[model samples]
Target: MVAEGAVFTTDRTVPIGAIDRWCSALLDELAGVERELWLVVAVTLVVDVWLTHVGLQHGLQEGNPVMRAAIETFGFAVLGLTKVAALGLAGVTRRLLSDRRGVVVPLGIALPWAGAVVVNATLLLRL
Candidate 1:
């Protein structure tokens, strides 16, 4: 339960502006470079999955052993789960590091996916 003075509480006496201010502040925190990095991560995830699918159809395969097992068991839907896990990892990173360093979390995730995209495209070309 929140204290009586809490910005967000069940107390109906609290003005609407308080809630708006609280939400605005949270959105403010979410704005900036870190937000852009998260966008990069999101784009790469979708591209990676699409490229992975195309590669599989063209005789290439998942290079990562763990992901291979996952795909074998759960199929392509595993990519969606992994994407959620990646975002969870980014959230954890955001908590642990400052904004500057936290950008690394998404960068780390994006780079490998981008690299895989390159490799997948190359292989597909060869086929």
Candidate 2:
């Protein structure tokens, strides 16, 4: 008999039970992707910080006036603090948005950080 939550496919021979199991597994994996999106944001942020650190060590200046002052006043450790604050903001954004739609929070953060990483890496390479 056909089972609840079973996935439909063109193949007719597969049992409904197997289809349901596969669908459940696929749904679980999809859920994990949303979680991984946040991980991507965190990782990119770290890499961006690391690249910025290296660039600073080589005499490059921070372009952001606020961060430049923070680095000058409090030193590079402020970068870590900013990361925590950013993730907190992202968490709030995630909570405020619909469950599935919250992927935008990480994507938005990660993309800019990734672009920064690319820019920093390219500039560092020229040195």
Candidate 3:
């Protein structure tokens, strides 16, 4: 729907390059935020798993089956929260792709591997 002359125009004056640069800067900021979210997820998962393991060990030592079950349940709940966060990210990514503002392509391109790393780190921590 863009006219030929308007294709590279912004503000009826600024060139498309300006828009590109602005978008790039915005994406860079978003990337940093995404990295932090992934880190939070990773750390939370690790802590959950470690706590679970410690709880299990204590339960076994004390011969308390109920306490072992309770700890495992709590640990799984934490892991489940991470999954929820991942799903939320996926939804946001999808919305970004469909956005008319045209920011999605860069974000989508930058997000997958980072998200995967978070998930893998979390799962590995549990083991």
Say which candidate scores most in TM-score.
2
Candidate 1's displacement at residue 65, Å, is 1.3
Segments of candidate 3 deviating more than 4 angstroms: 1-32, 60-127
lDDT of 1 by residue, 7-34 (tens): 8746568776998888666555644556
Each prediction's whole-model lDDT (CA): 0.77, 0.85, 0.52
Better of 1 and 2 by lDDT: 2
Model 3, range 40-102, lDDT digits (tens) per residue? Answer: 545554544454445445442212365446546674454445445665775576566634433
Judging by lDDT, tell me the better candidate of 2 and 3: 2
lDDT assessment of candidate 3: 0.52
- Tell me the number of clashing residue pairs for each predicted model: 0, 0, 0
Which lDDT tens digits does candidate 2 get at residues 25-94? Answer: 7655656687787888888888899999999999999989999999999999998799889889989988
Q: Which residue window of length 10 is worst by lDDT in model 3?
A: 55-64
Ranking by lDDT: 2, 1, 3
TM-score-better candidate, 1 vs 3: 1
Off by over 4 Å in 2: 1-32
TM-score per candidate: 0.66, 0.71, 0.28
